[model samples]
Target chain A: MSFLKYRLRMDKNVHLIMKILTVFSIVTILAILLGLLYKAYPILKTHSLTNLLLSKDWFPQKELFGLFPFISSTFQVTGLAMFIAVPFCLLASIYLSEYASKSITRLVLPLIDILAGIPSVIFGIWGIILIVPFIRDYVAPFFGKVSSGYSILTGGIVLAVMLIPVMVNILLEVFNTVSRGYKEASLALGATKWQCIKHVLLIKSAPGIISAIALSLSRAFGETLAVLMVVGNVTKSPKSILDPAQPLPALIANNYGEMMSVDLYDSALLLASLVLFIIVLFFNIIARVILRRLEKNNH
Target chain B: MKFKAKFIEERIFKILMITSTSIILLSLGAILGSILYKGLPSLSWEMISQTPKGGFYLGKSGGILNAILGSFYIAFGATAIALLVSLPVALYINIYRKKFSKYSNLVRLCLDVLWGVPSIVYGALGFSVMLYIGLKTSLLAGIIIVGILIIPVMIRAMDEVIKTIPKGLVEASLALGSTKTETAFKIVVKQALPGIITAILLSFGRAIGDAASVMYTTGFTDNIPKSLLSQAATLPLAIMNLVSSPIVEVQNKAYASALILTFIILFLSIISRLLSIKYTKNKSH
Candidate 1:
């Protein structure tokens, strides 16, 4: 009877501990939300939402607070990066999924994974060492006069390279997840393998591919180190890829330490962050919606 | 005639795909080659052993000894803290699915937000929090920032692994008169050990390679830290420091450090991938 009573006591204790842990998990989530809210506090308090959204100048130094330039530069970089990455990633994914021998896939996939693991700073370093000089000497000369060695082109190219592995991995996964039966059926109908991939596999996995692209674009938008290192930190609107420009992340990172006015600095940083948060949140929502749609269609 | 046309088209498609994939492979190769060509000659045993001093123009005056050690210390420390805070919560959410599962979606959303929050913002927040708490530019600040950064990744990975543990096994343990704790620890987590290890390795790779978040929070210093409170530079930060300097020699050293950092991350990622594959194979068996 005593042993039974002890067992009951232990079970109760275990239940209590589990309850406490669940609460802790919730608390962890709450803490993150609160942290983001705290970061967003300055923007909430000072600026009207519309003005904050629609303003153009991003000069925190002169108290000219607008995110238009940052947003434009971010879009430009992301657009260029995606333009460069999407085709390459799609073609690479098709090859890996459809054509590569098993042994080659085994070797190549891990190489891409290693590329994924290469730090952004290293990419930044490489861009600065190799790319900046090439651009300054060759690309810039063709485009006309360029002063700073670092340009928007340099940053965009580096960002594109940084994003390749992510795009390839996600797209490869999506391609792999496509049912083999679809391919076989298409092939049996006298469709060539490439035709099957183009019509059946690609179309079927379109939503996943879109999400992968969205995710990569969002990543490029928020990418800081490589962009900061390569972009010449110029605040003006860029005329060409050869012109220096400041994206949102690079702006916040470069100016955070140098801002003498705490209110202006914090507000600017918060605004930039808020914009980035919105971009990422929007992409996440889109991805989830697409995924749900895919699920529904499958069912 | 139709078959010949199809064969020709297929050949063209295959050639295009191969060329595109090879472009990616070539880009990676070029990057590695460029880093090596610039960085390799500067790498020396002495350079690896000595502490950084003065500027790059002053020449081979210092090594990256302190930064490498600091990198390992901060990464391991952050990983340990993150695992401690994330594992229990993952287990709690998993074991009590009915009560906690509703919150799991919210937890995942929060993690996604955290992951998407730019690293520089984390640095700023850490700087503010650390300054508020009177721990400015210390290793603790670095660890805290990194810990936050790792949490989202760790929890997400851990939750997936925990969910994958077969419900039947857990039920069996419970039916055998084991309590919930025993079922979780002995049956669920034990079976998921390899997955958990993979999660750790992933976080470790992330923490080691991370620079922007730690740059401001950690406040780079060349001195080897005597305690957690001491300011120290990490390998990534050291690389950043070198690249920014106007000196060519320092830039070369930066390249070397970048190479080393890349090598380490590459090694860890390969190991993690292998482990994950092995775990999957084991499950199939």
Candidate 2:
């Protein structure tokens, strides 16, 4: 009877421990959700979501906190990055999935994985060392002498490089899921290899590719390190790829540490974050929707 | 004639594919080469072992010893706390699927949002809360922020792994007259050890690489942290500090510190890839 009682006690202890852990996890999740809400509250309360989001001036120093410049810059850089990353990621994915021998894929896949592992800061360093100088000396000079120093071109290029691994990795997963029979059928139809890839494989994987680009674009928009290093951190509308401009992330990161007025600083930082959160949330939802639609179509 | 055309087409396709793969390979090579070339000249023992002092150009007077040690302390502390919090929740949702599964989906959505939230946002939130709670800018605040930052990653990774443990193993253990607790703790978790390790490693790498979130929460103090609440710097922040300074010597030290951080991230990633490969192989078998 004592042995059975001891066993029951042990079981009870484990159950108790599990219950506590569950409660802790729930509390942690609640805390994060609450934190996001708390951060978003100031912006939501002070500004109309439309005005705050669409206004052009980001003068936090004077407390005119229109997020338009930041939003535009975020989109511009992300747009530029996607322009660069999509083609390369697609080509690489094609190579990995359709063209490369098994041995070659094995070797190249891990290299891409390593590229993914390289920290953003290192990318920033590389941008500073290479991209910034190249832009200043060569690219900017060709565009008839832009004044505001670090150009959107620099930020865009650096962001493009940083996003390559992410795009490739996600697209590779999608490519791997392409039905082998589709490829075989296209081949049996006497289509050229390029024609088959262009027509059949690309068409089938289009949704997945879009999903991957959406995910990568979100990452590029939120990217702080490389942009901070290269975007010149100047608050203005970008005239050309070579014009200096402030991205939302660079703005937040540079000012969040040093702002003097509590309300101004908190409100500005929180507002930028809220904007970033919404942008990311929007992309994530789109990716999920597209992926689900693809699944349904396939089924 | 058709056979010859097919063979040539395949050959040309193979050549084009090989060429494309080589471009990615070459770009990666160039990036790494540029970092090493720019950074290697300044990397040294002294740079690794001292702390930064004054503006740039003061030469390699201080090392990253404090930052290196503080990084490990905060990362490990946060990982331990996050794991303690995340594991059982994963298990609970997996085990009592019918009773709590709705909440699990909610948890997952929260995790996804949390992951998507920019690190700067996390820093801002942590600053407000930590200051409000009187933790101030200290290692404790940094650890807490990092712990929060890593929770989503940990829970997601662990949940996927734990959910994969075959139901039959747990049922077998229960059929031997074991309690549910024994089936979960002794049988299920042990079977999922490799996955758990992967989760921990991924979170660890994330914590180590993090900068923006911890920047405000842990104010950059050059002194080594004497207590949990003391302000301390980590490698990422230290590198940032060094880079922003105008002194050439300090800039060199910054490069060296950047190299160190890069190497650490590289090593961790290699290990993660190897572990993932092993796990995949095992699953296939």
The prediction achieving the highest lDDT against the true structure is: 1
Error of 2 at A128 (Å): 0.6
Q: Name the top DockQ candidate.
A: 1
Model 2 segments beyond 4 Å from truth? A1-47, A146-149, A292-299, B1-20, B53-57, B98-109, B276-285
Where does candidate 2 clash, by residue pair?
A: B50-B62, B50-B63, B51-B62, B51-B63, B56-B247, B57-B247, B57-B249, B57-B250
lDDT of 2 by residue, B1-285 (tens): 457765677677667666666777887887788778878998888777766555323563668888988888889888988887777767766764432255766566556555766777778777878767777788888888898888878988888888778778777887898877677778878888788888888888888878888878988877789999898888888777778777777777777888888888888877877888898898899
lDDT tens digits by residue: candidate 2, A4-51: 678778878867787776666556545755776776687678778788
Recovered native contacts in candidate 1, as a fraction? 0.54
The 10-residue segment of model 1 chain B with minimum total lDDT is: B96-105
Model 2 / residue A217 / CA error / Å = 1.8
The segments of candidate 1 whose C-alpha lies over 4 angstroms from its true place after superposition are A1-47, A144-149, A260-262, A292-299, B1-8, B55-60, B98-106, B277-285
Model 1, B1-285: lDDT tens per residue? Answer: 356876888898888889989988988898899988888998887668888767533555878988898999889999998897777667767875642354665566556555666677677666766766788688888988898888778877888898888788888888998777767777778898988998898889989988878987877777898888899889987888788887787788888888888778878887888899999999999
Query: What is the DockQ score of candidate 2, to 2 decimals?
Result: 0.47
Best candidate, TM-score = 1
Per-candidate TM-score against the hidden true structure: 0.91, 0.89
